[model samples]
Each structure stands twice: as structure tokens, then as C-alpha cells.
Target: MLGLHKKWCLGICVVVYGQLLINALLTTNKTWNELDWLDILGEGGTALLILLWLYFILAARPGGRVTNLMGAGLLAFFVGVFQDALDEIFHMGASTPWHSVVESVASPLGMILMTVGLYFWRQEQGVVNRQLKKREKLFRQHQLVDTVTQITELNYFKYHLRIALSAKHVKRKFTLLLLDINQFNRVNQRFGNAEGDRILHAISELIMLNLRDDDLLSRYAGDRYAILLANTIEAEANVIGQELIAAIEHFAFKTLQGERVRLAASVGLACAREDSVDSILMRAKQALALAKQQTNSSALGQLVAV
Candidate 1:
């Protein structure tokens, strides 16, 4: 995460330095009597709060579109608040057009940008929440989260699948993709379960990276994973399943001893119908059985679409 956000730190430094330069150039000497105490308190407080916000945002979030938006917005906010604070300390003559522009224009523009950024941030969170729903039986509890993959387990996946099945606006056309690593047991036997656990964790991260942010991924038990793709058709699900299979097949995970271990995955794709989540899962399981059968005959497993 530090490596991901190193550039943002540089950008923030630039903004801060630029603001300091502006303050040095434009600010005037004002006596304590000339400064309005109430305005100083208000503007200084606001600026401090914005600075804290900027620090938190950069420190907390990874570098991405949403992070960029919020960072730019926070920068704008700091600039606005800093300018406002300067208005309290500096005695800028009415003839100066620049100070007036900073005083009048910066705050609202910053607010507008921040509002826009927040809107996009909420949209991003919606996608995250959709994915989180699959891994959580109840939204608020953190105990149910899988410690290894940082996803949910089978019980949580089932609980939410049922809710999705019963939603009024349900498409009745969702898909579930189940992926099981071929020869996962051999990795444990060869390297040990600790190494195997690391491999599973790596594989789960790879699968999540390939999937849409709204798609749900969970550890179904042991080496199997289940994904819930809402509003997806069988054809699309097949494409996704195939992509997952290909991705896992291509992934070269390194063992602690510096040996590379390539893995192949069997994938099952099954579309939901006007039936219960249990029935849908059973169909996916059946598809997985076919995929495993095919894997036994070939070096790499193919996606079995049902």
C-alpha cells in the first residue's frame, strides 16, 4: 500500500509548498487588533480539519480513480480553507483582484469538487458493498469473514444467495461459477499446508482481480471457491468461468523456497432459474463434477457450462 501511494505523497507535498509560496507572496502583516478572532478561529479550525482529512484519505485508501478524486477534492478543500484563514490574518487592499478571487471563488469550487468526488466515492462503495454482501451473512459482523482469503465462507455465501434469489427486482438470470484447483492436495503434500494456504490465498486474490467489483467471491470450503454473478447470463458466465480457468492456469506462484508452482483450475458455470438457491448451487456442483471429470482426462480443466 505504501508503494501504491508514494506518488500521492509527492503530489500532496507539491500542493502544500505551492500554498506556502502563495501565503508568503500574498499575505500582509496584520496586528492582533486588526485580525478578527472569531473569523480566525473558524477559518483556522476548518483548515486544520481539512488537513487532517487529507492525511487520513491518503493514508487509508489505495491509489485508484476514487482515491484520486478524493485526494484532488481534499487538496482543493485545503486551498480554500487556507485562503479563508489568510483573509483573517492578511490585510489585502480592495484593489487587489487576486485575493478577492481566492476569497470568493476557491471555497465554492472546492465544495463542488468535493461533492462530486463524494458522489463517485459512494458509487465505488456501492460496488464494494455488493461484493461484501456475498461474504457476509449479516452486514455488520466482522467475525464471519474468512481469515485466509479475506472473503466469506460457504454459510455466508448461501445466506446471501437466498436473499438475492428472493429479491423483487431479481433478474432470475444470475450465474454461479465454482473453481477448484487441480492437484491442490499435492501442493500440501509437497510443500506443506502452510505453503498450500499461501497458494490458495494468492489464487483467491487473482480470481477477485479478474472478477467485477460487484461480483461476489467466497471460499466454498477447502480448495473450492464460489462466485455469484448477479444479472449475468449463462454465456457471459461461461466467458467469465473460462477466463478464471485460464488465469489460474497461467498464474505462477512462487513457493518460499523460490520454486515456481504453476496451477490449473477447473471451473463450473451454472445459470440460475425460477428455483431456489439450493437448486442453483446443485446445478453448479453438477457442472463442477463434469469439469473435474474432464480435468482427469486432460492436463488442464475446461470450463463446464450448465
Candidate 2:
């Protein structure tokens, strides 16, 4: 079946071949009991879903240049996910070759492809829904991506938020998670804005990795990011939010001068209600404020103990 899609399949097959060769040269297999089965399930499940989507994309679409381009983009995502699931079975230590290379490159490459696809998809939808009105002026493609963080800008996020809200079903629910980086300005003052910008980019990438692909991530403003999660209730959003926070916490970012930086994030959760964008944003802002306050208190207590 894949043989029919030549170009699309070629790129993915090459990546798989290289990955296999690298693993053969560098990695050792973990014992059955030592493997993290749960993590494998999560990562493998994601890969399976991407593969299924790829299959549907090929099966449903007619042969065309656009279809092949989309297929190639989807293949990048599949490779990234496939690599992640493979990591669970192999005990690749800190010295693993191409460990950082493939993930750092492929995932973002796929993300950019998917994001561009979303923009074109939105433009196509705009023709069908002229009611969007003045909102079209805000979406100038390149302008919708943040300069520093490279995620979608606040305006772009609002655009997607409108779409998500409008497409809402009576039975289906979507939730929003707002996250603020703790003591971000202090990091800037201490390590210069260059380092701070790098941290923002890293945090943004980390948040993206934790996302379910369907989720929307945008830089709400400085040191703050917003995520729109589909089919999520408050409880599920809370779990996902915590996972993001944990991912940020565990990320070991280093400065130019060899200083290790510890990062923490506070999340505010809000679910869609009455389909009002402003209303949901306000709730998320309030929750974020409260979370920041609690984070501040915890820091204060730790300082006092010291």
C-alpha cells in the first residue's frame, strides 16, 4: 500500500533505516522487567494513532501534489512518535547518539508543517464562513507566529478559540489551560534576555511535546502560554496541566556561562462555557492569578526556611 505513495514513503523509510542503524551501533536493549511498560503504551499508542491518520489521509485523498506533501508532513510526525516509543524499550543512556538530534529536529519540522497546514485550512474555511468579519485582518500568516517563542501569537490563538467554540457540540467539551513561567523576569535580569528568550523557546517546545497534537498552543503574552484542549473536562485538563508543569520542571536548561536553570510553571484551568471566548479567558486569567499567588507563597516559605 505504501509503495503507491513513493515519495512520502521514501522519506519515512530513510529515517527509519538511519534510526535502526544508529540504534544497532549505539543502544543496548533493556530487560523485559526493566522496561517502562506504561510509558511504552502511551508513546506507542500515540504512534499508532498517527499511523492510522496517515493511512486515512492516503486512502481518502486522490493522488495529487498536495496529498503527497501532506503525507510527507505526517510521516515526520510518525517518525518522531515511533522514535519516542522505541526509547522505552531500549536503555539509551546519556551518551546515546542522535538521541537529541532526531527529536529536536523532526518534531519541530512536523509541527511547522502541521501549523502551516492549519493556516491554509483556516483560509479555506474563511471563504465558507464570511461571518468572521474583521478577524481576517489579524491573520496575516507569518505575523500570527510569535517572534521570540515561535508559537502562535495571542491573536491567532483567539482565532482558533473562536473556531473551537463555534464547532462545539452539546455533548462535546473543550478546556483551556493557561500557564505562567515562575520568576521569568528574574531569569532575564540574571542571565540576560538572550538566555531568557532561549528559555521561552525551550518551554514552548516542552509544552508542545506534552500536547496531544490536536491541542492548540499560543504565547498569550510574555512568560505566559495558553493551550486549548479538545474533549477535555476540568478534571482531565487538570491532569494534562500537571503533566506539562512536570515536564517543564524536569527540563534541564543551561545558560551560556554553564549555569543550570530550574524552571517551574503555574497553570490555570477553565472549560468552555456558553461558548463565550472572553468569558472563558477571564476565568483562566483568574485561575492563573491564584496559581501564581500560591507559587509565590511556596517560594516565600522556602526562602524563610533557608
Candidate 3:
């Protein structure tokens, strides 16, 4: 594309150069000094436009071949415009030896700058093409899996509830598990927000890795996560909950001061009933509250029937 643009610029320069030559030789009725103000404005305005385009391309699309080429082309085109604009305002007569030399230099200089910019633009396009190819592959893989819909919170609950009820006909049940990191606010208060964010990301990844492919995970709230286990019974859900507790218990996170901080999580599991999604979530939350009250510590897990 940059090559095409450069070629178009070169063509315009050739046409403009021919017009200047013809006007110098045959147009005896108009003197150079008699040039209209509009003529000067037109030429100067074009030069300014070319310069602005060059500036934007350089500033916005750095490290790209098309941008570099367009930048160079604009640079060359501006040179011609500069000379033409000056010719309108100043009567640099054809008889002056330097006048012809100056006018002749603009076209060639513009062409050279444009050519160099196009070369870089082509190199940048190659890199972009590779990135696009990788993106295409990722898109194809995503099509094969059942992905969650990005919707409002209310809609998400409604949709998941419908799915759960439909699955019950096939003897498939769902379990909801909520995990809250203990004293997470203290970490933010003591270490920093950056450390807290890192810890959250690490724990989320661990939970994701341990879950079945059909399980859904979401950031429930600050320091808390909700997991939706598909086709899971209460007994199986308890086993999974135990594994998650053990995994988090064994994880050794380092503080900003390089001290190892032991972290624990409180888990609440609830089996889904024929009721709404809201009811299931509320029961799980109540169970979590009970666990926290009974144990008086973060490292607690409970399973409550809804």
C-alpha cells in the first residue's frame, strides 16, 4: 500500500512540474509578479497538508513500513510545494541560474524520500502479517469450545440457571463454590495494591488449572471467587473443595520484602436445587458465613444443602 502511495505522489509531482514548465514558457499574458493571492494560498496550503500528513504517520505508526514510506513521500512532496509556493509569492525569474536549479531539485528529492519510506513500510507489513496469522489460529480454537457469554450480571445468572435446570433432566447437577482469601485486605494495607493484584492473579491461575474444562470461574468480588461445577454431585464437589484448600494452603507467596507469607482460603460449597440461581448463591454465602463463624479462621470449608 505504501508503494502505491509513493507512486501516486511521484505521478503528481511530474504533472505539477510539467505545468510549471509550460506556464514559464508559453503564458506570456501573466507576469510572475502578477500571480494571484489565491494561487499562493493554494500552493502553501498543499505544502502544509503534506507536512502534517508526514508528521502524523511518523508519530502514530512508528516501526511500520507503510508509515515510513508515506512519511518519506510526504517529505519529498512538501519540497516541491515549498518551491512552488515561493515561486507564487516571489518572482524568482526563469533567467536567474539558481531559480531553475532550485525548482528542478524538488521533484527528485521528494521521490528519494518516498522510496526509502516505502522500503521500511514493507518490512513493517511483514511483521503485522505474522501477528495476524497467530490471531487467526487462536480464533479458530475458541470456536471449538463452549464459552460463557459476556452479559449483565442479572442475565448471566438467568442463563446459568436455565442451563442447570435443563441439565437436571439428564441427571446432571451443578455445585457452586465460593473461595475468599483470608486477611486479603491486610495484604493491600501492608504490602501494596501491586502485591495484592499479583497474589490474586496467581491464586486464580491455580484454581483454573485444577478445575475441569466444563467448570466456570469468575471473580465474585474483592478477594473472593465463584466457581460453577457442571455435572458435579455433592460428594464429588467436597473432594474438589478439599483439593482446592490443600492447593492454596501449600502455595507460598513472597511479599515485597522477600519474606514468605503463608496464605489460606475459606471455601463454601452448595449443591443446586430446583430453585433460582439466586437461591443457590445465597445458600453458599450463608454456608461460608457459618464456616467463618465456627472456625474463626480463613482455612475452613463447608458444604450446605439448599
Task: Sort every candidate by lDDT, greatest first.
Answer: 1, 2, 3
Across 161-244, the per-residue lDDT of candidate 1 in tens digits comes to 898888787655688888899988998899899999999899888988888856788999889999998789988888888889
lDDT, model 2, position 252: 94
List candidate 2 stretches off by more than 4 Å.
Answer: 1-140, 300-306
Global lDDT of each candidate: 0.82, 0.77, 0.66
Q: Which candidate comes out best when scored by lDDT?
A: 1
Native-referenced Cα lDDT, model 2 = 0.77
Q: Model 3 compared with the native: what TM-score?
A: 0.49
lDDT of 1 at 221: 85
Cα misplacement distance, residue 157 of candidate 2 (Å): 0.6
Question: 1-306 in candidate 2: lDDT tens per residue?
Answer: 555676655665687688767776688888888988899999989987887887787776666555665676777877777787788887776887577677667777877776676566567557744433222233457667789987788888888788878873777788988888888899999999999999999888888878874677889999999888878887778778888878888889999888999888888888887857898898888888888778887752110000
